[model samples]
Target: MPPPARRPVGTVTRGTTNPNRLRRVDRWIGYALGGLLRSAAGSPVVVDLGYGASPVTVLELADRLRGVREDVRVVGVEIDPERVERGRPLADPPWVDFARGGFEVPLPAGLGADARPLVVRAFNVLRQYDEVEVWPAWQRVVDRLAPGGSLVEGTCDELGRLAAWVDVRRGEDGLATPRTLTISLRLAGLETPSVVAERLPKALIHRNVPGERVHTVLGALDRAWERAAPLASFGARQRFVATARSLREDGWPVVDGPARWRLGELSLDWAAVAPS
Candidate 1:
């Protein structure tokens, strides 16, 4: 089947994006899925779903993924045709392309409807949407994922200082669910880990109520960060690593080791911090 004729995917976004604004998530994508992308059978397709305002993220993604696999193909999709037009001039074909589309995860022209992508990065796109709309959006995008593919959804500050995202992948039942949630902090002049709460993806953002699981995890994290205060003398990196280790020691089900923790990132199975 072909995509809807004269039909576009989803709504137009806020169209606000900055250079390097999505670096942390991009870096995480590299660390988390680069191997899978590298070993894909052929040119692996990646969608920068709702890459707002600029093509920088798309271009940067291609450049970064090319570091893992030369044949990495990236398509920047935006419902705003103007935004797509803005990016088209900047993108290099074959490896990087731009299309006016949305959650349907439309592949560029010349690809079949079955051309599911190996990865879809939709950052800062859902924050403006009603919380109830998130899962439906995820379902739409997830339905387009190639085998072993992923849909990374999240929000970040304008400068990319703090980032939080849910890594959605196929669960044991072969349905998509939030698998891992990762929080990335800049670590420079950082005081507490809870600051990332402000950047949590909308799906989990409001769910940070006092009795909710996310709130519970955050409260514990803040306390552990304070307890690790003595390590501040060694530098923020050490303090963060100690705090992350503390999280694991306290049975938080941390999925990443000290290496990523030292980089001021902590990833855990989303079930551990999911909303009630």
Candidate 2:
């Protein structure tokens, strides 16, 4: 007789999902990890953990990544068996697949010796857990990463207009450390950059209060946005560029330059907004 199946780690989410809802993060990954994918040997796997209710995002990720690495494989993982089945019809063999798993990030059986994923995008997954549960969850996912791989985890609003995520990598000591915090916004009608406080990753969401580094950063962002208002006549994108420049000028350690800033996105060293 076959052995009993082991249960997947982590809880099922609310299953909320939508098409194009993950475009912001997908675009960021294609830009941020492009070189990593290009330099990897053979095919590199990417896991869309907790892809909740649909595989649209998985399909989208594969489509975007193929532009960077033609052989990139994408696996959509969920703890819910029904969601897995729901996505199977769209699976395209080795290039794109659906699996039933959680933070353990189980890969397909017999997927060669280098079966670990190079990038694990776990968006909107941990918001349902207690804040204390986050680090353990991150560690579980990070443990499954290939050398030099990354675990991108965060939360976003329903419409995907506002989003924030942490790029976590394994340190030399084998511990997972968040290396950067990034905020992406739809600047067309954006009122204040601090509005992202509502969509911050679990690690920093609650930390967006006085005495916390995250709070301090968001406050500075709001001030910068207001100061850049005069540039709005040039367009929202230009105004956002100015906001990003202002942040950098104020010694905020902004990561990217005008090219990325025009996309209404900004990334800062994790130390800048890590919880106090």
Candidate 3:
């Protein structure tokens, strides 16, 4: 006999999705965290939570990660059963699948009980929830992660031009911790790196006000970006690289280097910009 299905944790989101809207984070998943997938025991499972009205982004995620690990499997998880049905026809099995779920992160039954996700990218999922709900939601997702797995949660603009996310991983104490805050921009038309403040994850969004650590960080990024304007004549990418360097030089604890900065992205220890 079939077992009764357990209810999925979390709630229905706006489900607003667009093609390529998640490219920046997907690049990060493929490039920066690709090693995790490669070292995983078996074919790694990645969860695209709250993949909204469409499954397009989850499909895109699968295609991108396949370049890193050919056996990578992606599950588009949505609390909306209708959206789940909408995505099933698009599923290619083993490579891509759609399931009705929320932060609980359900996988296909065939994957077996040991198949926890190596990465859970929950972009824009928590935006609709109160800031107070962020940590709890993160905990729920982290609890479902495979060892050494990570949960990337945050928000991005509709066009995918500006974005910010927190990479949450389990700590030594077996609790979730937001280890780093990453901001990715479309350098071609970028004005200032601080523009990401508007797209920060739910946890830090309201903390952008004065006196908060995140606010200070954004202010510093803006100043550094302004100081890099002369380099803009070379290219936005170059200018952004300079901006990233300046942040590190000024003791902002920037992570990565010019190689990543060239991608219009910057990352900092979560401690550096965590709410006061």
Best by lDDT: 2
- Provide C-alpha RMSD values for all models, in order: 1.8, 1.0, 1.1
- Tens-digit lDDT track for model 2 on 183-258? 9999998999999999999998888889999999999999999999999899999999999999999999898899
Off by over 4 Å in 2: 1-3
Off by over 4 Å in 1: 1-6, 172-174
lDDT agreement of model 2 with the native? 0.92
Residue 267, candidate 1: Cα error in Å is 0.3
What TM-score, over all chains together, does every model reach? Answer: 0.96, 0.98, 0.97
**lDDT on C-alpha atoms for all candidate structures:** 0.88, 0.92, 0.91
User: Which order, best to worst by TM-score?
Assistant: 2, 3, 1
Residue 50 in candidate 1 has what lDDT? 94
Collision pairs in model 3: 15-52
Question: Model 1, range 26-126, lDDT digits (tens) per residue?
Answer: 88888999988988888899999999887888998888878788888899989988888998788777778998888887787655556779999999999
The better-scoring model by TM-score among 1 and 2 is 2
**What TM-score quantifies how close candidate 2 is to the native fold?**
0.98
Q: Give the clash count for each candidate.
A: 0, 0, 1
Write model 3 residue lDDT over 1-276, tens digit each, in one string.
889988888888888889999999999988779889999888999999999999899899999999999999899999999999999999988789988888888899878877899999999989999989988889989999999999999899999999999999998988889999999998888877788888999999999999999999999999999999999889998899999999999999998899989999899999998988
Q: On a 0 to 100 scale, what is the lDDT of residue 196 in model 3?
A: 86
